[model samples]
Target: MAKVKSLDDLKKIKEEFLSKEELQKNGDKSLGIVQIKVAMATCGIASGAKKTMDYLINELDNRAIDAVVTQTGCMGYCYAEPTIEVTLPGKEPVVFGYVDEKRAGDIIEKYIQGGELVGDVIPVNYETIEEHNIE
Candidate 1:
């Protein structure tokens, strides 16, 4: 870490740290924004989820898209390692598998930006507890 030389520098460092902390927390849920969760478990990492995530972060920022890219644990789709879950505001979340850098770009361009569905969609097989009213 670089030493802060002045108050302005300290503020900049704090802002940067807060930004990274927000990404790690994955709690950005502002309405009307896209939310992306990249699976980063052991299998996911081995399959290059880190690269995929970096691509997503960079592409989204480059395109000036309003999106939150965050890391998540295993999505239980080990067969489809490097998976990602995308949630458009006011829409249900969609899970896509086998994501690479190219595919990540496509996802941002087509799905996130253009509001179109792309390939490699993994169907949601399990129901949430809310669906079953198991409270």
Candidate 2:
């Protein structure tokens, strides 16, 4: 990567990096697939989330899976550290913990490709504001 010479250059680089997200956001034909979000907070980085993220992105691409991989902030499961949330189209999202390289591959090969759960899933015990009305 070349050094950014100005704000325009930086913006161009950012756009390149987020091209996949842009496609998903615009609903430009890549919809109805999988959405993957990797926890990338400080704690997550310390626990090797970056590697897990890279593994997922590369593996998914190599396997020709239509998915958008994004990075997100802390999920409040510090004990879980490197975690990922995968949401299949028309289905509830599922979070998995301790996502090392091997586990990431398993997730891709099994959960993402075969539609079977095959990792340490972090159960969702609460509903989001979007899921239900709150008084």
Candidate 3:
């Protein structure tokens, strides 16, 4: 990490640390807002997931959208390295692949804001433990 030279730099560092902590803690579910989990594994970073994540974070805040964006490990989709899983409150999580900045913007406008499904959706093939238990 770089040394903080000024109060502004220190504040930036603090905010970054807090954001990373929030990512690790998985954000606050009680807020009931849109939750975005970006795949940040090795392959994901190579595929530009970091850019997508930064874009999502900035755009969401700029648009004043209530969303929690977090970094996560591999989603087992190396072919779709820059993938993201979006979960709207009271809805099932949807995983989107090949998510560059433009695609991410579309996802924010169409899916997150308008509740309309966009392209590049990677279907959930496996059952979750909760789903299995419920069945």
Candidate 4:
């Protein structure tokens, strides 16, 4: 890391960081942004969810993609730890399991950027009451 010796350098760094923060904050359906949820439960951490989350955050920013990367608790998929749910604007969320850094990168490139589906998605079998039209 270079030393911040001048105000100009500090301002440049601040600008870059602020832009990323703005993108993360704007990660909502109204903004047509992508929302990413990383499972951070004990099982997930034991399976390397932190690394996967870091990789996604950095990669998303580098790609200049408008997205929010948030850490979440257990997703009830302990069998397949390190799970991530990606929700694109106006679309149902897709959950992927066993995601390492490489898989995370592939997801960002293919699914998020190119709008194509990637392999390794975990099937969501159950549905909420809303889906059954039961109030």
| lDDT per residue as tens, model 1, 1-135 | 788899999999889998765553444345356879999989999999999999998888888877778899999999887899998866778999989998888888899878899979999999877788645
Could you give candidate 4's per-residue lDDT for residues 30-115 as a string of tens digits?
57778899999898999999999999999999988878799999999988788999988767789998899998999999998778
- Score residue 130 of candidate 1 by CA lDDT: 75
Q: After superposition, how far is residue 119 of candidate 2 from its true place, in Å?
A: 1.4
Largest TM-score belongs to which candidate? 1
Candidate 3 lDDT for residue 81: 69
- Give residue 68's lDDT in candidate 2 (0 to 100): 79
**Stretches of candidate 1 above 4 Å error?**
1-31, 133-135
lDDT of each: 0.86, 0.87, 0.88, 0.87
Judged by whole-model lDDT over C-alpha atoms, candidate 1 comes out at 0.86
TM-score of each: 0.74, 0.73, 0.73, 0.73
Clashing pairs in 1: none
- Give lDDT for model 4: 0.87
Clashing pairs in 2: none
Deviation in Å, model 1, residue 28 alpha carbon: 16
> 93, model 4: CA deviation in Å?
0.5
lDDT of 2 by residue, 14-69 (tens): 89868755455455334766899999999999999999999998999998898879
Candidate 3 shows a clash count of 0
